[model samples]
Target: MTDQSTVHSVTYDLLRTLKLTTVFGNPGSTEQTFLQDFPEDFSYVLALQEASVIAMADAFAQVTGRPALVNVHSSAGMGNAVGNLVAASHANTPLIVTSGQQHRELVIGEPYLGNREATTLPKPWVKWSYEPARAEDVPEAFMRAYAEALQPPAGPVYLSIPMDDWNRPLSGFDRVRTVSHRVAPDPQRLRGFADRISASRRPALVFGPEVDRSGGWDAAIALAEKLSARVYGAPLPDRAAFPEDHRLFGGPLGMSVKTISDRLAGHDLVVVIGAEVFRYYPYVPGDYLPDGTALLQITGDPAAAAAARVGDSLLGDPGLAIELLLDLVAEGSTRTAPEPMARPRELPQTPNSPLTPPEVYAALSRVRPADAVIVNESTSTMAQQLEWLPTTRTGSFFATASGGIGWGTPAAVGVALGDRDRGVVRPVVGLIGDGSFQYSVQAIWTAAQHDLPIVYVVMRNHEYSILKSFAVLEQTPGVPGLDLPGLDIASVARGFGCRAVEVKSGEDLEREFTAALSAGTTTVIVVPTQPQKAML
Candidate 1:
């Protein structure tokens, strides 16, 4: 028989075969068995909470555009990670999450950290969930998890690894290689789409994050050129996928339904690529587009295309569809590039008091590296910031598509990691609100520990300013429990080994932001503003 001591050694070998070198987790008692015989090539990323672990993995997958590995303890740990897992499911981030399970013998009876349905607990949030039927099947279970996590509309997958499995013999098992299938568009469908666009005098292309994720930028641009179409990024893409510098590229449409309609008016045909038809917030109601407008959507996600508020849905691989469509359309016969939308005028800044959000945004805009990634969660400063620092590219910016707070800070960490490997290590600037920052503030430690260069710009307004705005707009008698008081953001960041500064005015912002970026490591700049001004 193979020696028991070599079981974990073999398990580590299997992990290496899968190329899962990084493991994100918060250790617990039940996980110690799997941690045995740890290999030097495998790195453990310590997160203070399960949420941070899953979130970091989510961002890592997004930036790297591949499946990422994550680990958690028992049921309780899995529960803590559920929220972010849901976000991953929504964003289609492929992740493999393994949680330690009680030993097989103790699972049916009393034991510490035991939960009967540990694997099924996150069923709805994960695309696949399983517990190995036998000790030797654990490694194969991981292979299944990795494959499922990489499927289109990829999402988090869960595996419950029993304690005994870590030390079990696996002499007969073969490590399975995971393969991805390529999806191509139907030639006839592509030709029909091209014919429709070629026949339309005023056509536009609308896009979402999938364009970037699916490597469809060239195809999307080619289709746009074929149709002489104006291309606009989706209402609020979580990240840029299309190049914003292209003349045919228009700006992002915000969450306002009326605003989207106003902007898309006068177009006879709208071709949406790799995006949901529309995503709206705050209950705005109106026709999704102006009267007499027609919408066509091409996406890898069938559900997104089908669920669009208004559109003719074409479900397929966005890149392939665009490539085929480009072949069917004629070369020339182009229209004048539509005039670039006028930039929003910045709100006036008052110098006598705290720095206005717009002033802070303007200063950041000036100092920001042109190619840097901007991860925004500045809820209160959204309007002013958008006006001041308009995203010019499809994939150069990112925000919370799940409408969840706390994603921006850690997501920036993931973005930096993703960029690091591609030799495109642009600086990551996180525009986060103080209230939002608290959601997963522990992520700062990950950034600092990895020596990731990120500038976390905390818009400190001392309140859940978005909620306050809603309360006032509704004319509520009093807004209750909305204040986020007594939070010292700068100190919190510094405690995580990051360079920290507080900026209360434009001058302070200019000096501090410049210094933070130049410091060349994780830094937090707390920009304090009046509550009302922060909301503007």
Candidate 2:
């Protein structure tokens, strides 16, 4: 049969046309047909586990701003892939996740590898999920998945193809199409919103990851400066949208409703752009807004806009909306600019004493490359990381939007791969907590195999410190399984074929970290940090 006559050939052509030439996967017996005679131009990134497979694809897509292709085994692999799938969804990373299924003919008989309920497996996490009803429809299904995945509020999508369908004959292929990824805001509505900003005596601007993702960083800065407004990074943002070192930057918004509301108490107007009206965890119940404060939000996510507890939300592209707001709002305001947030106190290195989280971050920050990309999962010390290692550029920072732990390790691998792919190879540093590192530690092997330059700094506090903080907050004392006694993180990294070491002093860390940054191979630096009380 001619190249275009078979389902496999046409599908490969479609993927090539869409520039999804790299595939992340963990192979299984059911996927063999699809792998038969894999094209020379395509690269397959193999991760030891499906969770790692999904996370790597997630960060790769995030950094490259393209829909990444992922292939996993049947039902079992899909189940293994769910945690990172949820993270990818919340982060709005566009991933086209596919799985091999039992042969179409064998599926009816309930074969061992069949994913009978494939469409429902990745539910709520995926934007769309489907199993091709016929062999000829596989390519078309993929095309639809691409569109769904790249659309505004972009997220992961899934498709299931029977193992035997790859070679099925097809008469022709469908014409490829382009989909617009941005949705413009309503001009009149934006104008009305701009009027409110102009009228307010005190205004506050809250920026979120979407601002950075949509290239609105400069616009956000302009808007804040125009109004002499305080700029707060959205709480728990997956990406840094504003330069943290800017004088106007007011630090991150609080994670709780009361905290956020209280922080903005004196502001007459609060404009949250490119994020949810709010994302709250550990429920600290209070008024959604402080007295005499008016809140408004601009976001591309309809669901985020709709789900907001209190706020008038404008649905559209946050970047586009902010650009429009800049023109409509007054050129300048007479109101006094709000004071910048207080900087964290500098903690100097103490010899022989266990290193504090701040000291570790301070050491790394001192030598951090200007273009470095940080994949942070050091949960207990996140505030400290933010304080010490500021993100001043777009796409310089990444964390799980879903508050999930495991995504960081594999995601660092993906970020390095993305940077390499785009020819702007930034140093990738993964600041992962010991508890978090264990979740998908296997992913580092992929980096070793690919010879990517990535430095993984494991903050070994030897416990789930964040959970313990929650226990304190909830008044639930004596929580079992809160502490992790013995985990030799360096040994674990060695097993994964990475150059590994354990360092306890700041001096040692700075030396090893600087060396690892230029190591030209994946390196894991495990630091035994003194445990500190966690803060929300």
Candidate 3:
């Protein structure tokens, strides 16, 4: 041992040195020792359930651009968190997911609560997963997990430390080094791709969340301007990569294969930047490509680049790749500017009308602080939200990249925690659906406990409208759980120690929403609206 230190002492030193001072978790008996005499500098964001805890960590990691630490119970806790764990992995969020294992002696006998194969629990999702063979190996495993999580195409990584390991004395790690987290592109290949974009008569750019994650937003816009290309945000983007209000913005692509192909058919060369080659849902059988369109996708994820359905791929940093392309593309007389795309309407106020998603978003647009961080999971109203909200601010929009339903509310709490910790005092707002709200309703308690200033606007449609749409579209008959009845969301929020209110009409919306914002210390305003959807 280099310094002859205890395991807990060494681990604490590493965390403080690395500036990883925040943790999020739901504690259990096995984790009690790890939490003993917990350091005061390290803020622990607590949640009632494992799912909320991981999601809260996921959002914090995304915001801080660093790996956030999360600890869970044994296999049961991991099982509870698997959904959000998969979602975080899909978003490539850098989260160090650690779990407390049963005592080493008991583990051999497959005790009642032992995670028999602990490492396999988060497999295929975590970048690396391990349960150290020896107590001394625990510290080394943690260091490796942190480094691997911060590496490019970053995602969650797992470490299962035996409950007794935290107290073991005389610890030493095999190595301690700085982690480099970038993969620069090959020069020759990048140049050839740039040449294609420069030569194409008609080009389009598909911007995705990685553009934001990789700090490529400026580069994405610069490249589009240089080539005079029409820009479309990749389908169902959890991150708003481009300014929706910009003239260059062509709006988001769709979830169906044929729809995406149809949107890009007019352009000869399509460049998908910093996102998956394409992410489509709802089994609509059709060709992925148009008759003649060619695709070039630039992504940081090796898996995304390798598994692209049809497009050619460039593996590198999204910001770096775009910056290089901007430098390589030459502007000429033939570099004709494309026509500006359709802009979202700033609809005039319709007095005494039924409260709809579009109207609610429009109202929010008028009142919300310009720099507010938007965490949304209003799935059915997502299309309307995208149309109405202009995510011009960088890293302002976030969604469930993995299409998980219950992340929005807890994610909002996590975002507030990050904003507060970073000294970024932007109002954190979450737009969530009633059905999605019920999934993690307990999050309000966490928010209240921390005194986080988060304004939650629940779109109370009293039904799983998105599921209803999908059911009708796919010809699924007699779905029993689609309707959500007798859910008093505001009352429940109040029960969780939140300031809550309900809005029954447009007048109520404007008045109560404004009041919620003013009184916000984790406030919830439930606005019951018609189940009738204007658009799918």
Task: Provide the TM-score for each candidate, comma-separated.
Answer: 0.92, 0.98, 0.96
lDDT of 1 by residue, 134-178 (tens): 877777777788888887767789988887777776564466686
Ranking by lDDT: 2, 3, 1
Which candidate has the top score in lDDT? 2
lDDT of 3 at 471: 86
Q: Pick the candidate with the highest TM-score.
A: 2
RMSD of each: 2.7, 1.3, 2.2
Q: What is the C-alpha local distance difference test score of candidate 1?
A: 0.78
Superposed Cα deviation of residue 43, candidate 3 (Å):
1.5
Higher-ranked by lDDT: 2 or 3 = 2
Instruction: State each model's CA lDDT, in order.
Output: 0.78, 0.90, 0.85
Q: Flag clash pairs in model 2.
A: none
Residue-level lDDT tens digits of model 2 in 334-442: 7887777789567764553678898888889888989888999988898888898999988999999888889999999999999888988789999999999999999
**C-alpha lDDT (0 to 100) for residue 439 of candidate 3:** 86
